[model samples]
Target chain A: MFNNPVTSLAHVKTGRLRALAVTTAKRASSLPDVPTAAESGLAGFDVGFWLGALAPAGTPRPIIDRLNAEMVKAVQMSEVLERLGALGVEPIGSTPESFARTIDAEATRWAKVIKDAGVKAD
Target chain B: MTSLRRMRCANDRLGGARVALVAAALFAANVAAQQAYPSRAIKIVVPFAAGGPSDVMARTLAQRLNVAFGQPVVVENRTGAAGAIGAEYAAKSAPDGYTLLLAQVGDTISMSLVPNLPYNFQKDFAPISLVGQTAFILVTHPSVPANNLRELIALAKSKPGALTFGSSGAGAASHLAGELLKGMAGVDILHVPYKGRRLPPLIC
Candidate 1:
């Protein structure tokens, strides 16, 4: 449990734990001064706790696009940004294309990592 | 003119009028259907426990979407199997755009970690947008002799398999990240899996 809002919600913000390295390419908005894993000598380490919206595969394109636009608009709202910042989460309003790519790439990368590590699910 | 030809011409003119009327009716119905979309409540399914970031984010977005759609939007938490249960629930749900999933990275992680997952991350769902990303921080106990990634690797190498880290589970992001560190740095640190995410002492 580190600075992930998903894991350290009650701890990270309270400064009970200090960050030695973050697993993103850049510094977290909540902890700007903290260096990234790349900066900390492990180059190309860019894993993040990401979230996205998804619908059933047969969902209409119009509905999918509408949801994407609405999500993008919602995330860009100043209030939303402020709220996410308070929670140590970075607001990303990525398009479906980019989000799909991210999902694929992350899964592929993590798959290889898991295979290499011999990690299994509980 | 032949009787058949006369009837054909007359019916052709009638057919033109009928086609125009039907086309207009269809256009109106299509517009009506489009307008009717989201007339009902919208549900965003969270694949994790309540009070987590995904649940909170979905709730916030649900509030905004409710305001935008002028329909009640709700957040439903379906916790199990590290989010696959909720994802499958959303995947098998009606494709009417009423039910959605607030998916997380764990969904994909489970694809590689969990065998025979209920749904395919890429195939079973249509991607909407990446709501946000949480940056994972690597923190250590004050007593652990490491200040940064390099230092941590060095410390692990100094005592092979002596340094142990805890993750949410065997196939969690934290666990994979630790394994990645070992592969990248060539260090031997044992990975201990926890039932769920917890603070260092509790996890260890």
Candidate 2:
């Protein structure tokens, strides 16, 4: 039942499927009326699908910075914003350091969740 | 005869000098190419099928980057292993700036879920800017009769193991969302995992 808004939003609009809640900290802009899981009684439920760009390890820092600058600028462009918004995605242009920290934090959090839930890749 | 020998030596020295100059020129050109930081086409590898959210996002960025850098920025779909196949490929590629991976939450989670993965997500890749993020929507068939999250939790509670939720894959973000919901809500909904991001026709 966990589906992306790209494929599921149309269904929710047409009433083919009922969206119970979005699994994120805030309400999805595309579906402003639908409550987030936390708002709907699951106090701390927050999950989201994020996309980040990555280069192989040892890529030069200057190159990384250049790519980062272009990415930050790209995400802010009105055309890119419109394209991403149609998919129910919120653009986030972050520093490489912050992105690295996010990866580390998410890895740590999901590691615990997978271990506790006994989840395995098939 | 002595002049002939001297002439041969002079020719040899000139040839050697010419070769050294060419070698130095080529080396400098290579360095300049490297310093240019994308002298050729840049590839963005998406570890998913074409037309999915990840691919879409990658393609969108690729188009913009192609214009911004004045070089071809293409999106390559290297689908398999719930994103590990493409991830491993990107990780092992030359550490040049041309190759990049469109990474997602599942890539990070795979660090723990899949054993013997060839590459480490944290160790093998350098983070760039985060493009965007989308939330997963918990939806159900109209027949299930759950109006909202609370109602759905209650229904799952009453029915116990009867309710089923489907995800894109076993360790995908969708599956983890389901697990989180189950753990936090303390319900026992059966998890049905499909092969790709697309759910079974009946569920959607």
Candidate 3:
């Protein structure tokens, strides 16, 4: 089913997303569609990734684990998360092994997409 | 009289040679200045539109990096096709550390998003330490009176396929974030695509 506002807001006068829609419309009327400011609350969404930091495919496990431990410690700090959030950044702290798997997976995924799309280096 | 004229002519030729020597010395000094690493200025490429988050971050960071390096670090925006235009330009730049790319998540994701990109992220460039990362949050337009994420989801669920979320574009992170919210919240919000940046601005 589709519950999107551009489609649904016309129907519900009392919906929360609808309420936001109203406020956002009012805000836009006062502001330019694209503001010169680099960071503004007008755009209230965070969308990006912080994948695992990878080394050579065969790098030793000990070093990888140590790096992961350091990253985990850094990301776990409440202050760090808050700062990242303020900048619209999400913090993802995951295991080295897991991160490694994700990196490999993403690499393969993109490679296939490129191949399928007939994308090549220019 | 002939001898005096010859002497004068020789003197003039020697003076001309001295002037040539000084010119050569000045040219050498200028070459020396150019050869000096970061002797004058540095440039950073922000492969995104100006006034966007990444561009702002790059400028801010460039200021700090400039202070650290004792040189002027300038930010140049080369926005197009997500970030391909900037990345391609950065790759073609001098490998000298003076010219660097202030790449972020979008640049990396472009590898997956932009098929058959001309440059390889891993091959053409080096990863300087990551500056920082921005996180995505699920915010509804303030029009919806449901406070917090739960109520928003509940309200959307009550009206399945009746809600919509604006995202930057198809295949963008915001698009995925909306999709992820749909999957996790089990609420279907139609995806409204915007031409530039994130979708939230266009929706409002």
lDDT scores of the candidates, listed in order: 0.81, 0.88, 0.52
The top-ranked prediction according to TM-score is: 1
Q: What C-alpha lDDT, on a 0 to 100 scale, does residue A5 get in candidate 1?
A: 45
DockQ for the candidates, in order? 0.64, 0.65, 0.09
lDDT over C-alpha atoms for residue B88 of model 3 = 82
- Flag the better candidate by TM-score, 1 or 3: 1
* Candidate achieving higher lDDT, 1 or 3: 1
Tens digits of per-residue lDDT, candidate 2, A1-122, equal 88988789999899888888999899999999989999999997889999999999998787888899999999899999998998889999899999999899889989988988899877
lDDT, residue B202, candidate 2: 30
Pick out the ten consecutive residues of candidate 2 chain B with the lowest summed lDDT: B195-204
Per-residue CA lDDT of candidate 3, range A1-122, in tens? Answer: 11222233333344343232212112222122322111332233323343223332332344334334544555455765554444444445566455445444555644453444333332
Tens-place lDDT digits, model 1, residues B1-204? 699999999999999999999999987976676568888998999988888889888988998999999999999999887788899899999887899999988888888888888789889989999999888878776556666668777888889977787776677777787777778879887777776535554111
Is 2 or 3 the stronger prediction by lDDT?
Answer: 2
* Cα misplacement distance, residue B29 of candidate 3 (Å): 21
Candidate No. with top DockQ: 2
Expressed as tens digits, the lDDT of each residue in B39-112 for candidate 3 is 66767787777866566655655555465557787888988777788778877776544566656545555777
For residues B93-191, write the lDDT of model 2, one tens digit per residue: 998898999999888898898889999899999999877899999888887777888988888888888888888778888888888889999998888
C-alpha TM-score for every candidate: 0.85, 0.84, 0.52
Name model 1 segments beyond 4 Å from true.
A1-16, B1-32, B202-204
